[model samples]
Target chain A: MDVKAEIIAILKDVTGLDDVGSDPAENLFADGVLDSMATVEVLVAMQDKFGIQVPVSEFDRNQWNTVNKMVDRVGELEEA
Target chain B: MHNITPYSSPTYFIYLLLLLSPIMIGLYNGKRFRVYETFATVIILITAFFGGNMSQGISLICYILFEMVLVLSYLRYRTKENSKNNFWVFFWSVILAIIPLVFVKIDPLLNNATISLFAFMGISYLTFKSVEMIMEIRDGAIKEVKPWEFIRFLLFFPTITSGPIDRFRRFQKDVLKVPSREEYVALLKTGTNRLMLGLLYKFIIGYIFGTLLLPKVSVLALSYQHQAPLGLSWWVLAYMYVYSMYLFFDFAGYSLFAVAISNFLGVKTPMNFNKPFKSHNIKDFWNRWHMTLSFWFRDFIYMRLMFFMMKKKLVKNRVTMANLGYLTLFLIMGFWHGETWFYIVYGLFHAGAMITNDAWLRFKKRHKKSIPSNKFTECFAIFLTFNVVCFSFLIFSGFLNTLWFS
Candidate 1:
């Protein structure tokens, strides 16, 4: 699966908000697609599926708030 | 020379209004006279501490210095190049921040024999702020930490006692910027209106319900405690509504005063209540009532619990996980209120209501065509929610325990 697609799917599934109009750069949090709860779900799902452990303590919503940013983060973490 | 809690009395408002004039003037003239603001804040804080309670004042000072060292050190650790952020460090920072509050809440449970020396007014709110800062620092959301700015945010007098808890970044934005003349004028108008409305709610309506009516209703209800039907009667119902009203008016009125004061100083603090009685369900009620505190819980507790459960794969079913989350969140909230069976039950009651409400919502969503949807139904939902919430308040009031046990 495409990383971006997977990221978007995880967010929608976690939040139960279908048809979230996703621009890769669009902010999920700011747009009300992902709240703090949904963000947790997304983070956990990412770890489970992608094996990327984004520490909650080090999670910056601003930097990882968009699908593209999240994808990039996963890519970077996976590489590391 | 009685030291009263902030905005507790009309005289406190008089003193506050007088003290705020220069700050208001400075903001209106496009100048944030930082020095004057600092001096005024000190005076008010001193009044809160020494005017009535010297012990609390000393406690407050100790609490501030302790939190300052912890936060500053945490910030430093976070910024270090190879610091390999340890979870224990973050955990301890948070634990230390709330240690004072933990003792304070537990003090009442120790047979009321020993008081927690760390107890002080606004300790819970301060702890909330400190914990948030630590989390932000760990997240690298707060890149730099200045001691004075951190202190200013912690000591921001408006909403200090009871907060519509402001976030550090959100508050920093307001603190660093001067509102335009037009904006400042609007803030003044809104602030004054809020202040007047708060006065009406707290002093007028709250006084009528809490002072004049509550005692009478309580006596009436107590007198009829054994009237059957589970220690309930018409008077108990009346007590429920009266107590709920008193709670709402008193807290909402206090919130308005806090927001108004923040606005007067050109800072727009968030609101705490949003017509909570109009909620259609228990979940909706939580969203509307004590909004900041609930949101804080949602962000810090519920969400985190959800993630932890899912990561550990502790609960297989999502619905069950959500239910557990609500239970955990409210139970903690209940315990936070005090170490009492009544408080715990009150928390469980809401958790049960919310879980049921969510199930109902899911059912309704699936059966939208069959389920009746109309103005009458909507009205009925509001009425049902209001009554249920009132009953919960009755439980929360501990009147049942008093009637049955005491």
Candidate 2:
């Protein structure tokens, strides 16, 4: 229902898992929500879902490394 | 139209280097030309279009048509939420792509299959890249793409010939941004090195090997008449394959140069080779060698053949039938290389070898409890596979494949 819940659902869908527990700091990749191409794929889905284009430069940056970080970044993109 | 012959005089070198001077000036003027990596190839296409003979013009048009498919796909993806039936669109695009190739290779007056295009169809590869994008879209793997990004992926001039066969999404990402300084330097250095190596391999090794081996082949055909030489016939045929191996490495080197430069310019063209020679078996070799091309065959033709066979109830036993599936796939692959009868046999030859190799692996698994594994056996199999590959190429282009069989 909240941003955190949405992020967890996204991660679960990506990883094809039943549950991703409620640690806002939980690692999506380590918890098997994603693999090596995780960051890019998640970032892409997020952009497509939200209809916002993250800056080309931000892709190489560390902002999309985690679910919380990515949500915050996407929120920023929307605001901007 | 501009001339497109690379086999012509050294004038193209002077022309290209001088032509690039203006683009460099445009870069200095802060133009937005840094948006794509295949920018360098635009110059070549321009040159060909301006001065290329009739055939070259035809090839150029085929190339543009391929670029158009990518353009259309990107636009449709942007506008539509869902396109479940994009498969047929891509299929027709492939058929359209080959029209130019057919017209160029066989004159329209003679060949009934001619599509009445002006020239040959060398741009089918670009069509493959575009078709892959459409497939990805149908699979719901990509949500959207930019127009320019799609153009860069399809028409990025550097890979216009003998491609490394890049994937759509990955290449789209690669071309979206400018290259960092370090990346640029690495790309420039590697690209130049490979370009030099390609020149040497093609001009020097290919020419020299052809000169040495071809005459001997002609002499044998002449002198021996009907008598088979000192049983040296097969060996000579094997030697005839030297040019093919040389040509592959040469073309591969050119592709590497093209892709590396594209990367340095902030475009991410996919790598085409992966130590193909070291593969222990035919299937493994296919996986490593010209991987993108093989994948193209798999996605467009092979998978369809397999599904078709299944649907037709043509395959009785699952395993044996599956081997037949692989057989048809590689044979189709061989034919795709060229349209000649030699290419047909070549494709069938590879299909047969790969099927036999797979059968042997299954056999080995069943007998694993009785026989211990040996490095020697594995190494021997690989060595033998290389010769088998070499021999297949001989049939693809040499006496037996062309004259004996046909």
Candidate 3:
């Protein structure tokens, strides 16, 4: 799977919501689907899957609130 | 020379308005008068610290110099190419940043003295900003730490004394540019509204509750304490509610002034309270009450610890990890408040509440079909949460210590 699909899958797994990928731009946090704990799980899953280190401080809620943004952030981190 | 505590008196507001006029005009015209703003900030700080509080002024300068060297050095180390990002270096930097606050907090115990050589108004809030910057730099969230911007963020006069605890990135964003005319106008409106509300909350309602009712309730509670079980009487209950209101109005009022002044200055400092009494759970209460501080704790302490534990597979159970996080977060928060027994107990109490709250939430999720959800239930939840928080405040009030001990 591509990075976006993989992230969606991770979000699906963490939130237990299958429709989390319906809108790639949907805010998981604002929608109450992804809370702080769930956000941590998603970050950990990314580390395991993408091999990118996302420091908790670098996790801006606004920037990472959507699946597409998470994908972009992961790509940026990988490049760096 | 007159000492002017931020937002302390009518005269202070008069002086502040006079100083802020030019900045407001600059913002209205889409210009940021950075030099003038910095000059204003210096004037405010001098008035706040250089009169009768001269010693505090000296201490604040030393603290700033110490933190500047530490943060700037850390920034240099982190920005170096091929930097190893040594964990010990980062750890020691945070420790050194917090040492002044630690000395101030513990000074009361060491010499039975109320003041410490390191103590200064807003030391705790300034320490929070410094420690946060170091942590962010380590995390690569903050890539550059300009010296002037760093000092401005640390000593941004309005919220410097007691904070709504603005983050470095957020504050830097505001400081780097001027708001549009429309934005500035809106800010002026909001600032005006908050200033008026602050007056009502702090001077009127807060005075009624704190200056007027709190003393009477305390007296009644104490007078009836000898006859009641566990020294708990109806008067004590009244004292709890009264003190809670006083605490909310006074602090929230102060926060309003800080935010209002910040708005006028085009900084947009975050609001500290949000009708906290309306919260339906302890977690919700935290989100609504003293929000910046709680969010800071959630971000800097709880989230980091949880990540560390999860990363290390420390406890294996997510539930256990979360509970431990709450325990540590609240304990640290408690100690941060002071070394007093009541403060510590207050921290433990909230930690316990959070743990129980999490379990209750889990149970509710499991039994979702069986449980009824409606307005009445929602109201009941709010009522329950309100009383629970007020009781916590009572413990925080240190009356229990007086009632039981001296």
Interface RMSD of each: 3.2, 13.5, 1.0
TM-score per prediction, in order, is 0.89, 0.69, 0.95
Q: For candidate 1, write residues B140-229 as lDDT tens digits.
A: 778887999989999999988889798888899999999999999999999999999999999999999999999999999888877867
Q: What share of the true interface contacts does each candidate keep?
A: 0.64, 0.00, 0.52
Clashing residue pairs in candidate 3 are none
Better of 1 and 3 by TM-score: 3
lDDT of 2 by residue, B71-117 (tens): 46544754475545555665665566455555544553374755545
Better of 1 and 2 by lDDT: 1
Candidate 3 chain B, which ten residues in sequence have the lowest lDDT sum?
B110-119
Better of 1 and 2 by DockQ: 1
The regions of model 2 sitting more than 4 angstroms off are A1-80, B6-32, B35-42, B62-114, B145-148, B216-218, B229-235, B303-318, B401-406
Which is superior by DockQ, 1 or 3? 3
TM-score of model 2 relative to the true fold? 0.69
What lDDT is obtained when candidate 2 is compared to the true structure?
0.59
Candidate 3 residue lDDT tens string, B1-406: 7667798775778889999899889889989888898899888889888878488789989899889999999999999999899999999999999999998998877767755667788999999999999999999899998888788899999998999899999998998888889988999999999999998999899999999999999999999988999899899999999999999999999999999999998889999999999998998889899999998998998888888888889898888988899999999999999999999999999999999998888788668789999999999999999999999999999999988898
Q: Model 1 in CAPRI terms: which quality?
A: acceptable
Distance from true position, residue B83, model 3, in Å?
1.0
Q: Distance from true position, residue B327, model 1, in Å?
A: 1.3
